[model samples]
Target: MEVYSKKQQIISAINALRHKNQTLGLVPTMGALHRGHLQLVKKALENNNMVVVSIFVNPTQFDNKEDLEKYPRTLEKDVALLKTVNKTNILVYAPTVDDMYDGLTVSQKFDFDGLEFEMEGKFRNGHFDGVGTIVKRFFEIIKPNNAYFGEKDFQQLAIIKKLVEKHNIPVNIVGCKIHREVNGLAMSSRNTRLKPEHKAEAPFIYKTLKTAKQHFGIKSANKVTEWVEKRFAKNDLLQLEYFIIADAKTLKPIKRKSNKKTYRAFIAVYADDIRLIDNIALN
Candidate 1:
């Protein structure tokens, strides 16, 4: 796979493809590639003539400096993985922080129609602004016909849809299914940092979600949430942060169910020092 770290070179290359009427796809990611990331690549390759996977750990998105500092960066291994997926027609854009924001700053406001102030937005201050900044930059730089993302970051996927519409960006935003481990943990780069024992226990996150789903129609929202809390309380290593059932579209908390609308249960937990998030559909 060809790699470009500069914006102009990549843009020039992509424009050459555009001249040929070649359809381009983009899979934007932070380094530390895994099965989850490759799944995105696989989907992109199936649909587009050319795919560009951009791997740069965006610093501005982190609410905590320490979290950003500890975030994984394994570029060599990441590239190797991408090559294994497809060495032809795939361009890896591994750019420097300066490559994206050389002299200008990117901190802008977005209106998600009240979608921004939901679970993730409420917890991580200024986090989505950073997400918006980097994603907008990549959208402008790559100018792909389609951009793919995993629904593992469900709220982020929702926010990105808003970002595209609010700007009238001429690209289709595609949300692929959440990739998971055999034991059911939603695959994440942070999963690599889990303590060995914590890794063994990490699948419990998905297990709890499944349990929550099973209890959905059988129990009230408050009772189902309390059940999730009690279930996690049984595990000393798993610390529950917050659990709520919210409208799938608006992401606003739903106190009760409606036959006309869909709801989902979103949860955040800490396995020792590592934080993980997951959500499940609830009828």
Candidate 2:
């Protein structure tokens, strides 16, 4: 378990392995290192000869300045947690913001077809652009044969797949199953910021989504949307920001899901000021 911060350092290490014909995998993260993140690393290690887990809290991705400031930066704790995975081939890339951005922290706009205008894109302005820029940078720097992400951000996963196709990047983008708490809350770095009571109530987000999945075929998409909206509205602890049943590929909200098209339920919730997003396949 070695650590490198600069892009050149990791690139140098990866290049050495490339000469030996070793396959490489990457798990890019903002580094509050939870079990969810480790799952990505484990999957990467199983498939590739080497793995790089990046720990930069990218500034370009946050539309709200304070959310960026308040975002967790537990580098020491993060490294310690990564060590618990107990793999020698694993390496950590904990770059400084300056190291990653070279001083300027701006996101390049990307066209994710119409996929960018729904859910997360609709709410967090310039968010996916930041995601695209950093992800593309990592793919360029490490040049991994495979990259792993969790499906918790279902829409973001779709955008990244589109990104690879749009750019002709060679790396395979792998979406892992969502890791969750025993209580059913989708694991997120932001979960660390939840208030005590709110933390207890957070599992309801997944619970509600599960119920909504149960209702999809019986109810129309609009009615299911209504059901989810009402479920959250009745909850006193958490606020529903948006919930949509959309075609999985294009991400357009659907009136009625066709057997021909795969669909999923996407939700965003606000517990006081902290925000969380989750999705589940409805078919």
Candidate 3:
């Protein structure tokens, strides 16, 4: 696999591929590659003629400086892992922060049609705006035929879909399934920072979600939320931030039965210093 740090070289290379009528696919990721990320690469390779994996830890997306500082960076290892993929045609774009945003400034704010004011949006403050800025910039630079994103960040995926729609970006956005550990903990870069003991208890997040999903239709939304809160409270290691059953599409909290609309349970919790988020369909 060839690795390019310069934007012009990668763009020029991709242009050459376009000349040959080779379909291009993009997998955007912050490094410290895990099985969850590799799954995206695998999907891209299967359908597209050539795949470009961009490893950029976008600074604009992080509202908390400490969170940004602590975010994992395993570039060398990440590249080595990408090489292990079965596909022969793969390029890795590992750009520096300046490489992405040297002279460019994102002044225009995006309206995700109130989709941004829900769970993650309510907490992270400018998080999705930062996400939109970097992603839009990448789309401009790469201009791939299709882009792959994991469903792990479901809300972010929804906002990105809106970003493409409002801007009329000419690429298909594909949301792959969420990958989890054998123990049910959602795979995440932050998992590396979990203390050994906390790591053991981390699976409880998924366990609680499964329990909530089971009780979803049987019990009221408030009761299910209360049960999850109490479950986390029982263990001091896991701190519940917010847990709500909401319309899967709008992400607005649901207090009563909706016969037509699909609902999902969205959750955020702090396992020690590492914050993890997960959601499950209730329909």
Candidate 4:
């Protein structure tokens, strides 16, 4: 696996690949990669002629300084894992923050108004703007033919789709399936922060979401929210951040008579300061 830290060098490498009639695919990620991230790389490799995985722990995306500081960094192990998957043609762009944002000040922010104030957005203020900024930077740098994101971050995936279309960026945004563990907990880099006990209980988020969907149905968004909230509240170790039944596309809180075509039950909880997020569809 070849690692490129400089923008010019990475661009030159990509251009050379293009010159050879290779189609480029990008999987942007923070350094602490897991099965979820690898799934994206696998999909990229399958569909595109060349795949580039970026492992930059973006500081801009974190709303809390402590969260940013504590975000995991296991680049050595991550690269080794990548090598096991494939080595010869894989490219890793692991660049510094300075390289990513040389002259770019995060002046303009993406509001995404309704979508910005629900589950993850309401709990972690300004989080998506930071996400938007970093992703915009990534798109500008890589300029891949296709960019892959996991469906676990449902709202983030929606916002990025809007960002790409609104800005008229030429890349196709591909959303991959949510990869889960044996116990059904959605795979996430933040899962590493959980203690063993917390990890065991972590699957409760998915289970709660599933229960809400099965019992209440989309016609009872409020009831679904209340049920999920109570489940989190019952767990003394869990501090409920937000439990929302929202329109998947807009991220707006669903109303009783609202269209139920695509609804998602989203939840965020703090298990002693380790915030975990999960969502389930209500369709």
Report the lDDT tens digits of candidate 2 across residue range 109-226: 8998888898898899999999999999988888989999999988888899999999999999999999999999999999999999999999999999999998986989888888
Each model's RMSD to truth, in Å? 1.1, 1.0, 1.3, 1.7
- Alpha-carbon error at 140 in model 2, in Å? 0.8
Residues forming the 10-long window of minimal summed lDDT in candidate 2: 249-258
Q: What local lDDT does model 1 show for residue 4?
A: 94
Per-residue lDDT tens digits for candidate 4, residues 1-283, read 8899988889989988888888899999997999889889999999998899999988777779898899998888999999988997689999888888885645258756466666787667778888888888888988899999999888899888988888889999999999999998999899999988888888888888888888654437777677777777789777888887777777887775354368778888887879887888888
lDDT of 2 at 252: 87
Per-residue lDDT of candidate 3, residues 1-283 (tens digit): 7889989989998998998999999999999999999999999998899999999988877888899999999999998899889536888899887788886744347899999999998888788888998899889999989999988899999999999999999999999999999999999989999999999999999999998999986998999999998888888899888997889888889967879989988999998778999988889
RMSD of 2: 1.0
TM-score of each: 0.97, 0.98, 0.97, 0.95
Q: Of models 2 and 4, which has the larger lDDT?
A: 2
C-alpha lDDT (0 to 100) for residue 95 of candidate 4? 89
For model 1, what is the alpha-carbon lDDT of residue 15? 89
Count clashes in each candidate, considering only residues at least 3 apart in sequence or on different chains: 0, 0, 0, 0
Question: Which portions of model 2 show Cα errors greater than 4 Å?
Answer: none
Model 4 residue 211 lDDT?
A: 86
The ten-residue window of minimal lDDT in model 1 covers 103-112
lDDT at residue 247 of model 4 (Cα atoms): 74
